[model samples]
Target: MRSSISDRLSKMDKRLLNVRFKKSTASIFVLFIIFIIVFFFHPFNELTTVNLQSYPNLVDSLKGNTVISDIKIKKCFYYSSCQLNKVEQLQWRRLDSPLELYAAKPFRSLSRSMDIFNTFVFVKQASAQTVDSALVDVKITLKGEPINDSNEGWVSTDYDSYTIWKKFISKSHETFEQVDLVRDLDILFGMDDLQDSREYWQYQRTSIPVNAPVLPHLTLLKVPLTSHNKIFTEFHEFQSLKQNEVLLAKSNSLKIVQISDLHIGPDTGFCLDSSIDCTADLKSLEFLESSFEGESSSKPIDLVVITGDLIDSHRTKEFKSSILKSLSPILSKKIPFIFTFGEMDEVPLYEDKPEDENSPDESDLKVDTILKLNILNFISSLPYCYNKFVRYNQNLHGLTNYNMKVFKMPVNEETQLKLDEPAAIITVLDSENHKIDSSQINFLYRENQPLKSKDPFKLLFFHYPLPNYRPQGEFKLIGAYNDKKPLKKKTDMKFRDDIASLGYQVVSVGHEYKNDLCLLSEKIDRNTVINSMWLCYSSGAGASVGTSVDYDRKLRVFQIDFEKKQMLSWKRSALKGAFDHQMIHEY
Candidate 1:
């Protein structure tokens, strides 16, 4: 019986072997036929029109016969008189981040995939009729390239493309200027040239420590100009930047509350009234009320200012109003309100079509495509916490006629602003604008003249600090590969010489959303006693990511001791269980 079973099994094995050989031959033939069909059809071979017309920023490249073949840069701090000749590399690789945006992100950012293997450029509007619209379409053609699975990747948040472009601008500032880059340019590339970040992002999202401090380095920064199209360091290296201490009071009799980075509704996950279904704005306000612990005091807030990014996007009027109205009820307590614009609140200067009411497709675009031609009204329409945010001291000793008497001035308007009482002024100035140097409001912060006029002390409010703050023409950073973003062409000389002409004392700003502080210690060219002051996101109310060494994240609170003539900034880490937020003792 065993012999018979073995014979049957051998026969079955032979039949199966024959069938397997025949199947293999058929499969090979089928594959050959499919290959031939694909070769003849060549359906995926069609060129993809880049619609260079869609993005006008490339206008600078229009005059380029010689494209940006490669770039090299060596940059340093603006104060380092390191002479242009010593930079060694004309490449802006060493230039610090020229273009940067500050706002917080959700603990969990949505991983959305974006195709970034495309070309982009800045261009000027074609005609006068385009002024009101803030955008114009250009007639330009672009070479096409094919995309493969490798070109697409999932992004958990807005990919900051402007950040990437800024790196390019920073790295090749010399090369582009030397090449006579026009207002627009074209980015032509081959199919294999497309780059991707899927692997990079995957590692970042899965790797942050749960108990980490929300330092600027760990947070993600998205460019406000281009569609948040680039990604930089996620595991940011943290550092503490120390500054000179200023004592506000001998015994401490003043209360200072810092409400920071209140980016009104648009472009971020924290933005409420948007599609993300978040109440971050409301929550921030609620948290603030809790922080303050009560309503209008017989003693008004020592000083108060929103500190830039009053509105998330330049054109989001209704959204901004919602934020203002919500706060109006609180300010009804008669507390002072002051704020400024971050990169998001200002009109974007990229060369592109000013998408408007007529252009429904672009009506929802975030950037102000038409740069110089843009309107301040769109920006002015939003509510700023104060007419100005400044760096100055307030005197509390006076005849008791009211809760608190706050005296200040605004750069945008001429009238002297008097709020019920101010805990402190976090001035938000438009550093990009050249006209602010002569600002009458700034004179108050520098000199104590306003304090002499019945008021106990005189203070000021404006965005971005002078002297200490680099205050250079806005540009966009450092990355693993190289310095990614660069400044716009010929945009550098716009600082210093212009500032030397405008004399002022102290200034405070909030575009940097880290919890701790990085105040500039440089004294004004004219004044030795007064140092230009800048405190980045002194209070980490927003989830904006920070940069390595220079910034980080934490919820900060500023305390005032007027008698001592100093302000103590206290920051508590929201990420770390530790309550030690950090101290910017008196910027």
Candidate 2:
């Protein structure tokens, strides 16, 4: 043999050069122990020399006896690969006292190498006092010089921006309790309107001043009044037909499952750094498990609404607990969902702080009051689902309007009359940015004069879409009155003829992400007649922002039957390839 095969190839090349010299000395001793813990134990340096550079004459200051009045910057956000394009010189100014002041001058450079900007500001605080040296002084400049190394760029004083003023100074000390101001003026007015709320209790006692400084009540984010009386006794197992209880009809077919503008937080993602995308939370829990787990779906979702910008402008509590843990399969399958808010569901109302710096409760409360206490503690930790306890008035509209009933029954037991005949009603409201508030149209015309008569199947659920259902010079302006003759109002076709004389034969909105329907005729009387209603518009299940349309990103559904009261179907499902629901119109 050729010298015994060259002695076994020279002992296999010295055992592969001693395994590549012990993997290059363990990768240079693990990059020199990560460069000696990032430069001699600087442990990622800059602990606090808080300069927070976003400045316009920097003033956030307020400290103890609290009194900053106004700041209002509103937006600076940028980070979709930071492209601002224009804005050459923005400015703002106010300073005679109510401070204000903001500047920006752009064209191209808005990001000094952008490392997260955020910036919504809004300050205001004259009393609900927890000042804790309210601070915020940033100051950086470039072509107008002044960048002086105030520790050159690293201001983060463990900020949650004073935990959104410590949960609005602990809910302004539980709204200065006197039994929560008589249960917030009995959910606003009605003891024959309690002397019309005496100018709302003199505007809440002259905006907090019975010797000011109030902060405590944060009972570490309370929530248990025995979990709101066990969610009002598990919302009477969805009140089978409460008029004292029983009348029947829990389902003659309703379905629904809407889900619009679900811009599920951390500004959702198609990458480009909006991060968190466990495959967009597994495609939003695979579209609520194929709309109530469809095996060729035969109708089971009986009600799940959502209808709003369920977050997109970052209302972080890990973006509302990753959109309620991707709607924990519609709250662990006890279905019956609801919610309405939108306008980016209490948008970027300032949050920043949660890279886990030992987060016990890094409180940033006020993404519309921490999304109404994380939706009343996730609908009182679910499990008992029948559904009713959605009262929430907070003086009529703030906690996003309410009222639901479905396929109801209870009629004349010598007319005890609780919810006499409701074969389906709904009415969620809170049309966030297409605005509303004429005290929410006089609290939905006093809760719709006790559910407007028979021909039931009402359905209103809002989140905008009324400026005569958008498109056509996109109208908007839903409220305004004074400012020395302001006027505004008009939601046109006379606000859908006052929600079609409060009987609402379907409204179902969702800030125009696309999917349409229309119908909406007009003339509400004066004999000239006309009528019609519908409206529709859902298109948004998240991730379809500027274009890449597939019907803008589906999710609608509808259904209804109530002994054929109308609308037998509706569609537009598509949340990624063949999930299909596609019909868009049905009767």
lDDT tens readout by residue for model 2, 240-352: 44323222333566677677775654322333334433244345445656656762256556567777776564423223234444455676565656666676655322344
Q: Candidate 1: which stretches are off by over 4 Å?
A: 1-253, 266-279, 294-300, 314-317, 325-329, 332-334, 348-428, 432-461, 464-467, 470-506, 523-540, 543-556, 572-587
- State the C-alpha lDDT per candidate: 0.32, 0.43
Looking at model 1, residue 293 earns an lDDT score of 46
* TM accuracy, model 2: 0.26
RMSD of 1: 24.6
Q: lDDT of candidate 2?
A: 0.43
